[model samples]
Target: MRFQRSAVLCLLALLAIPAAAISQTMDYDRLDARLTRLAADEDMVGLSVAVIEDGRIAFAKGYGVTEIGGEPVTDDTVFRWASLSKGVAATEIAILASQARLNITDTVGSFKTSLRLPGGGEQRATLEDVLSHRLGILPNAYDTRLEDGWDPAKIRESLKSLKPVCAIGECHTYQNVAYDSIAEVVEDVTESKYADAVQRSVFVPLGMATASIGRSGLQNSPSWARPYSKRGRTAGRPKEKIVNDNYYRIPAAGGVNGSIRDLALYARAHMGLVPDVLGETALDLLQTPRIYTRREQARMSSRYRGTVRDARYGLGWRIYKYGEAGNRVVGHRGAVEGYRSFILFDPDRDTGVVILWNSSSRQPNGIGFEVMDMAYGLPFHDWMELDTSQAAAGH
Candidate 1:
């Protein structure tokens, strides 16, 4: 009888071990000190960071000022999402797919009949093609045109003028205009504007109150971080100056804005905490690797190359494989003229990080990875130190 009791107690203790580890508090004090020092060193105007662990927000805080000697950034301070909008847009589209409103495999030209490849006959690009960056469209072929006030319709009409750099589904080429065509596809399917669809489907469901899409969204925001760019060279110790550019024309590509707090909810949804809001199937589909994005290895800083074994593009997220076992990390990074943002999550560990900055710099990515490492209790790397070294070496 004593042996049985001892065995039961031992089993209970063993069962509590995993739960205890999962519930452990992260070293927020260390993170805070590091972020404060890095912001000062990098001349960052304002930054917001949030970490999700065990399917909930574990830590979230803002650093620095919204502008030079301006308002302090808070959890609710909105910032331009830039290309991070891609992940949000993809999530909404996946929701539509879950409801059978549209099939991701459906040819994009089926809805936007005007959009055609170079030959202009049968549409070779499907909805997945555009979402996964496998449309074979040359990178940013018409991004300048979109930025110059050209409407998405005009860009769609102009598709015939541009040729695919590679065969459809054969190569990965990042795009803005081509991906924005998903907006038109969504509009055709829902008979509503893209922003409205996103607001109704994604923001409302996720309770992301401060999240909005496009120029009007930012303008109407009650509180938002002012856009700023580093004044001189990338490595120069310079001040940040306020700057602005309108990207509403390509809303689907890079036009969403939200606060770090709101983004934490989105991250939680992706981590499978809110399955009823975003179906598990849809979430899986959005994150499942679709095409090899060879650019990640070459584009990422050399410091991260040691851990990142492979990379791929999913529906709207960039999937990174770290270590030999290839630990899965799904995330997206965004860069507009004056803003930089990143959101990274590990589904296996149910850990995620969101970093939004009003200033454009490579520091956010390194900081995000460090936070993730901390969440998983992995060996720490001094990313900021490496960043400083790279900058001094003119890398």
Candidate 2:
């Protein structure tokens, strides 16, 4: 009897998919079939996705397996949100500032002691710079080195070393070291660990019970999904090596575990669900364009070519004015080894989406785009997450 029970358990384990390819409606059935076929071809362990429409789940489903060696993704499968974690940080900043706990105008020099920008540019860096990637702080990638006594002084050392390629707002260099510096600020202001502040301000308020700030010592919950990459998605092992990559430094810019559904709830709230979460006033301030990246403006999607309008960059988001068809969309995408994710929303339509994928995402929702369109707007997801927002009322 024990042997039979173990066999049953094993069979059930093999059935896990991170977010299934099965979307919930006939309109999405075509994409559902394609995702089903790709789940096999790509060899994706699992993927879980959801679309927020008219304030409810238009569609939500899981697919494939959870980890390469695990079960399939279910509605509950947890995924590492990667850079999508920025929105969580942005949410905290909004809440704190709304309560007058901190000021967005506070300078980096004010927070971190003993260091100055290589050319003294940081003296001018305000809180807005840290949150918006506008501060010409260090331009390294995920380079946070948190020691036991890591203090404001060391952060200054990090900032003083950045090679200012240009003036503070001149170049929009998407950076992790700079944002992690903001994480340090979050710690200082809240008098809480960065992770703790994130939990209190964003995770808990949104009722995302599964969300976690840092690594856990506890055993893997049944919902935890393994990470996967594009190479691994195609004929490689379903579970790739968990490495000394993205999670090790655990910068504020990254490091949050979540599910597609949970993230959508968080995203939907940005559309004024209860501005009490961040306060409508503070939410408005965070979305304004503080720095515009010339790099992004000069480039156009290959698909759009010559006809593309110069894209714009806001404080924590990419700002743009699309045609009537484009006005309804906004959000961001995140990627790391063995995992990739997308979170976009249609503020005008009160819609949002979270795509928690264990394998490579050929985004703006490659195989996933079709189903995504049915829920919100279209495929216009861009990189850069710090809670990207659309035109909200009054700053």
- Which structure among the candidates has the greatest TM-score? 1
CA lDDT scores, all candidates in order: 0.76, 0.59
Whole-structure CA lDDT of model 1: 0.76
Per-residue lDDT of candidate 2, residues 1-395 (tens digit): 11122334323222322233432332555545655655564335677777665445556678887766567787777877778777667777778888888788877677743445667666787767666776554454324453232443465565666567667655566765456666777777888788888878787776777777655511155677776665533344444646333442444666777776677667666655545465557657755656655555465354333222345544455554333345534555677666777766655555556787776545334433344345434444322111234211100
Model 1, residue 190: distance off in Å is 1.1
Clash count for candidate 2 is: 22
Residue clash pairs of candidate 1: none
Task: Find the candidate with the highest lDDT and give its number.
Answer: 1
Candidate 1 at 34: error in angstroms?
A: 0.4
Where is model 1 more than 4 Å wrong at Cα? 1-25, 231-245, 386-395
For all candidates, the clash counts are 0, 22
lDDT of model 2, residue 289: 58
